[model samples]
Target: MDASLEPRLDFVTCASPAGLHRMAYWEWGDPANDRVLLCVHGLTRTGRDFDTLARRLAGRYRVVCPDVVGRGRSDWLVNPAFYTVPQYVSDMVTLIARLRPGSLAWVGTSMGGLIGMALSGAGAFAKAMLAMRPHAGMLPPDQGIRLDKLVLNDVGPRLENGALSRIGQYVGDSSEFASFQDAVAAMRANSQTFGPHTDAQWADLAKYLYPEQGGKWVKHYDVAISQALSSQTAEELAAGEQILWRSYDAIDCPVLIVRGAQSDLLTRATVDEMLKRNPRARAHEVAGVGHAPTLIADDQVNPVADFLLA
Candidate 1:
């Protein structure tokens, strides 16, 4: 990739119940642009995942991709229990305060989509929280935060149990590799659902996923981040599902749901229901993709670009 197309790496301190941790973000385009676009990664992915997409859309907006604490260059929480959406949402709000963008939009993949839903819905509450006492590392001006547009990549209000179980098995898998090739192969095998990519593309995807560190190729994200996910009971999941649905329904902004045609996660029925529930919502499906569509390809990126830019 060209150096000019690459994003500027930065970090922001965010408060957790345990303590403060730094959340890393990659910035692209003009810093002075008030129209902001936030691109958030998946369960075990990093902010770098958006490099290709960011390159395409950066001209129109100041694109900011966050590692979503516990992944990529962000700090891991002292307590694994803090690895939930609320904590992630809080951190993102802090990032927004730091950016102070006059306008905001969002693109979130999988787990990141859930955080977007939660945060986007809490616009009024977030405004009030920031006014009083919010965990933004530093107090920022009480400017209201709202998502003018949102792109939910392969996720929705309800998650499929079987699909989630399959994802859970791999999320915290503590597999170690002796060689970079071996680690890249492992990631490709594990993420087949992300759809087709060239060999070089796969290499690029794995670069941030399993950094060469401490004499071994290990996953970038903190494996302990899955603890809270594993302990969720059926009742808890059901309650969480309701909360997500409420959030989805409450969203006042236009939403675009991107689903892989072969996805086991976000179903067609759910997409249909989302459109029915939110009049401002629409859907787009990628051919032959599953679980999620890596928004690198033109086919996937173009539609999202149109939606966010429109």
Candidate 2:
């Protein structure tokens, strides 16, 4: 089966204090299949980042990849402040309601992994806070779907300040390129941490990174997403880290932590702590990668598939 041919575009309306916005998604495989796998992209990426992985998994699961709000084809938030994890989590809750799957699995890279950790590990108080929102009325009657398996790609509760600072420096840079090749070169330079990919793979990845507009190739996401990172102070990040640890501990499902061997974002110390906290959590280190491991390669995707299928 042609995975590209199998995917269909769809949208879900999600609510925010600023109002409602449409979140776009790509669905692959049998829509009727109750076993669902959700693949969410990194901080600056769109849903299309998972095209290769989604295609491979489509035969066994209904794969859904959403362009998180303010990225890809998803509508930008009326309030840039709403680009934080809480809002992302709320939007995902809305999406899950629409999918209504019997069993759910998650693959989250970078910021996406943070969102998954929030949803999968939220405690009673966190759930109550989410439910108290005005849009809570729109959530599924069961609240939200529980994850059966979770793949967190190069992110953990504890983050390296230096790595975050480096990411923050470039997260909002939206330079225009004269040609597609130029854009590809820029992406390759900035994303060397995503590890090595062939010239063909980099070309494929560039398609989603740059969207042509008015005859110029521009970055695919809304620039305001950077505000979410810029507004976070060190103290706030520390507090947030505490919250993430609580949530990570609350998770009952099997967890897979995909760490790029050279990652500066998720440190070996943090991975060790995570495993200590959750006995069910295991680590898979992708050699040569830095901040993240894009699940485009068979070596990266196979371990994830085996974990989910096991």
Candidate 3:
């Protein structure tokens, strides 16, 4: 495929406690298209994770995938403590202001999904408040951009501690690879939770996972991001759950919950609970997967496309 025809890289300025930073994004399709689809990656993943999905949806919507702060090409926070959902939510709102689409939809994977839920629910208000303070006069008047649709990929309000622990076990363990192939091998081993993929697909994924510097390869993201997860106590997690559930219940947009049938993070019981609380929400479980479905495969992408384009 011609690289020129692929998504264009861009960046937007966002504010944090450490000061100002730039958040990088990749945009596909017509820039003037009012229909916007924002695809966010998982905790340690980059916007490139959505390459396949973005290509499939570009003709229908203006697809934008952002590398969250502390990850991908985005700036690493001076204070790793700022690597929390609230900060991420703030950065997204800034990105939305820059996009200024007529309508917006979201496709979020794992940590990305949590940000979506917050934006769709009471979390929007949190962002609004954040914009008003500190960054006052930087954002335009609230345009009331409704979150038209949402696709939560293998994540919900309730998170399994065991799964989180498993993720933390390797998140910040950055390493230099002897070669590109070795990096791909490491990525495949650590991301087995992303389910199966062909060698070609894994190679494509690895390209974005690591970037070469000083004649060697290194993980693309800032390792400090793992600090937020590692320091969380049980009480803090429970409190966070209450906040997230409130946000979930407050959401009014149509939500499509895509679950990996074998996922350890989001369970069937949680999906059931999510459905009960939100009349507009539904679930579609993908077989043979574990923590997440990358939406790279046709079967996985089809249902999401149907929901968004419907």
State each candidate's clash count.
0, 0, 0
Query: Pairs clashing in candidate 3?
Result: none
Tell me each candidate's RMSD, in Å, in order. Answer: 3.8, 2.8, 3.5
The lDDT per prediction is 0.86, 0.86, 0.86
Which parts of model 3 are misplaced by more than 4 Å? 1-4, 123-145
After superposing candidate 2 on the true structure, give the runs of residues whose Cα lies further than 4 Å from its correct spot.
Answer: 3-6, 124-144
Model 1 has a clash total of 0
Cα deviation of 28, candidate 2, in Å: 0.5
Error at 250, model 3, angstroms: 0.6
